[model samples]
Target chain A: MKILSTLILLVALALGSAQAQKFITKSGNIRFFSSTPIEDILAHNRQVNSALDQQTGDFVFRVLMKSFQFEKALMQEHFNENYVESDKFPNATFTGKVTNIKDIDFAKNGVYNAIVEGDLTIKGVTKKISEKGTFEVKDGKVIGKSTFNVLVEDYGIKIPGAVAKNIAKSIQIDVDVNLEKLE
Target chain B: MKKKWLIIIGGLAAAGIVLALLVYFFVYNKPHKDYSKAKPDFEVEAIAFFEEFRTNAAASSARYNGKVIAITGQLSSVEVTDEQVVALFEIDEGMFGSEGVRCVLIPEKAETLISIPPGSTITIKGHCTGYNETDVILEHCSIAI
Candidate 1:
């Protein structure tokens, strides 16, 4: 009986520690910009959900397509109806891992370069992406930030010839999230 | 007769230019909807709204996504930052974490949202973006009460 109790206690402690290593944020921010000689377009989405498991170096993000806000109503409508087709594909998700998780100490308060490789799905098309970003740990909170470029054609987005000059072929995406301990 | 035709052609060209300019400004530079002042398309309780998404995400998203909605529920938590203010109405315990309706309030409602404590029932009106499998996100929310 004593041995069984000891085994139970060990399992409980293991689960507790595992939970401590998880960090999450439901209000993460993602901004994308398209620049062209004729016109520049920008959109911001703040209702991003992200989770990072420090133990396994896994990071995931779920972004609602309709949440992206543009400066002009016409651009927002076109982006949803024509570009991304938000009605058909409502979410964009990324599931990736920090490949160099061993180099950074989560307990330390500093910034560390992180290499993340994962699958990004947008408008029902999935692509493998490898990008570099920084993770800053301060006062037990983790801030993950990265900027990367995404090709419009790679995601199956086709710009019409009439307004091609107004939109860039490549869009720059910026991700900023402050993650808190799950417990 | 030739001079009259030239003047008529010039007048038509000037009118065409003015019409094109008006169309460009009105169609291309239209402003975004003001969610704060917009009427809610659907008003529902928080739990029921969340359950619909949890049960049939695709169907619910098709019906509610990109629409203005009003939801009433007990506030589970409030997160405030310099950039944004968010109020959560937790509906269930999911694999990632607590999942429910997450309303990102407009800047004008920051003070009102902060004053309300957790467990108090309140109504929020905003633009329903869609369910992210974890939470039904609403942007540009304002306190309906």
Candidate 2:
């Protein structure tokens, strides 16, 4: 009888906490860099839309392809027309969950290792990926950041043979976002 | 023979001048169209702009994507950082829910944006990157004249 009442109390507390566990960030930063022999090409998309369900560890990130700004206008034009083809593929997304949810405490402030496994889609192609990331709670806000690499060919992005030397096969990706509690 | 040689040299000089002029006009002195100085393609209300996308994303993107647009809307939030100033506008529920129209303003012109409070009406001009699933994002934004 005593164990049954304790279990019920724990369930009630979890339910209460779940209601306030959603976090959102409208301006997250997602950047990618490619370093090749001919040139080092990189772009930063500061308009990433992301949401996190803290109770369930569910995460989703979306960003417009045209939002990735380049230093050179010609490169930006080529990237839109030839490379990622922003007109055809408007956004890239990742929908997944933090796999190591049990180790992190939401109510407290700390840096915890998080492993995220999800479907990452780019250029209308989706791939299953698992990567290690970090979750840091500071000043009552959750900050999530991660770094990974993806090959251009992996996402069905074609690089022409002539300029292939200018682009690296693998591109490094970086993400940073400060999440606000969803009201 | 000497007269013919002089005429040939003179002709070569004239062709060189023309080539240089062409390079100056077409290559070196070409105009640079900055978004700050360029005219906006469209001026729209935030609600109406988002409504078009919500109704027909394909048509809206075809018309508005990759163009310089000016949008008027209420500021939902503002974020200032060392690098840039970001302004966010709400547009009801989007593909999933909770739609937003976000504008990233010019760093040099961020001073004019300080006085505007959240929920105040403002017009911003920028390059419309296009609508993602949840947000319509603009880059190189500035306070509209």
Candidate 3:
């Protein structure tokens, strides 16, 4: 009887472990673009790291405030010191949940639309936002993507009137992430 | 008399502009402690190096303009930005030889140093260049293993 009980316990443990495979990617890419008729500006930070908890549907992302790269060094410097103040506010983080984990299966290959809600902290300010994303699972890999808009004034970023119209008050963000399941 | 006063005011304004220009380019150009002034082959821990770098780049936390060396406690924290992937690692008690002189790996072949976990025992190899407020830069760093 003891041997049978031990065998049953081992099987349960194996099943539990198999159900808890999580996926994460720290080198995720996030980009922001703003353009006008006269000029077009682009910025991106590839160091955006993120993790997804498969068991609980929790997710987290982090990026160094100084990591956002621009086309020119002068523009990079201005973005950090003058605009982002990277030193004072070192990182931007997002903590959210990918709703409907049960509806999605990692073993199968298909596109699944998920609702994500979380607190996005940027420029030392935290805002609650709800966004939708399409996640594709194929060949033991998961790819997630989302596009959203954030208003600068809502985050207390001030632009001088001389160049205010040049920069859009609302900035659009695109996130494309590729994650590998952690064994 | 009015013309003379106007001339004096204009001269003062010109001087102010020149002063602002000088401070921005030259004076602000010089960071605090100026580790580039440090002698070659000097070694220090990662935390100490980041502290100095942060103080120097008070106006702007940008990339290192010179060489640096550091020892961190973890390897996973190493990252690259601005054509430089500054390595960040933690020093463990078992790590010997450097004697607590933890290291930060800057870009220059950072690709080889992948899959390093935190609190793991390992050795790092790199050229010490300069300090940024957050990292003690190793210009060209690779994993010793």
Candidate 4:
């Protein structure tokens, strides 16, 4: 009877872990592009932290603003100090749920169209957004990619009038995350 | 006499423009830190560093974020991504199983990666990216031999 009790306890613990199906990626990629008559600006941040819950269809992504690197050191410095104000607002985060979670099979090896609705916080302002994304499940990994455009004025990021010609009113952002099942 | 004054003013304006261009190209546009030779601002054991961040994330970030730090600890794991190499130092495993400090190395200059094995003590220098979940991250790391 004692041995039977121990077996039951072990199985219960195993089932508890299996129920928490979470996939996470630490080194995700985020890039932003802006085009103007004068110059085109581009920046990338590789140390993006993100996660997806398989059971709940919940998603979250967080990135440090200062981690973004640009080709020109001056541009990077201006982006942090003047534009994003990294000292006051250090990180940008997104938290939302996938609406079509039930339509896609987690165990299948194929690409599925997904819609994510969430709140994106940048420069201390939070805005609700929904965007189309691609979810690919293959070889024990989940890959996600999406592209969207955001207006700088909505987030209260102002481009000074003196150099306004060097920047665009809207910026295009690209996100790619390759997640592995949490073990 | 008027022509002489005009020539002097033109010459001074030209010199000012040249000076401004030189400063823009040489001073403001240069790289900020020479990480290959810059000394670490703070040196501490890996376990203590991780503990501080885990205990209080906000205070720890204010003290260490964006700063170059040196940490000594046992190598836990080495991961090579497509763009860079990341080394995790084992501070302590949680009741469940979570790691501690994670340092990402410069792919080009990570020459000392071959010598250190898992569980061997080593020192590394890098820019701290603050704490996230079970990790205290650093980027552009260089191992100290």
Q: Candidate 1, DockQ to 2 decimals?
A: 0.85
Tens digit of lDDT per residue, candidate 4, span A139-175? Answer: 7789999999999999999999988999899999999
Candidate 2 runs further than 4 Å off: A1-16, B1-33, B81-83, B93-98, B117-120
Docking outcome class, model 3: incorrect
Number of the predicted model whose DockQ against the real structure is largest: 1
RMSD of each: 1.3, 4.8, 8.7, 2.6
- Report the lDDT of model 3 for residue B44: 44
Worst 10 residues of 4 chain A by lDDT: A14-23
Error of 3 at A121 (Å): 0.6
Error of 3 at B38 (Å): 12
- lDDT per residue for candidate 3 within B78-122, as digits (tens), equals 544433454455322221111122233434345655456555655
- Candidate 3 vs candidate 4, DockQ winner: 4
Identify the CAPRI category of the predicted complex in candidate 4. acceptable
Best by TM-score: 1
Real A-B contacts recovered, model 3: 0.03
Assess the local accuracy of residue A111 in candidate 1 as a C-alpha lDDT between 0 and 100. Answer: 97
Residues forming the 10-long window of minimal summed lDDT in candidate 2 chain A: A14-23
Q: Which runs in model 3 stand beyond 4 Å of their true positions?
A: A1-19, B1-145
Error of 1 at A64 (Å): 0.8
Which candidate has the top score in lDDT?
1
The true-versus-predicted C-alpha distance at residue A140 of model 1, in Å, is: 1.4
DockQ of 3: 0.10
Give the local distance difference test score of model 2. Answer: 0.84
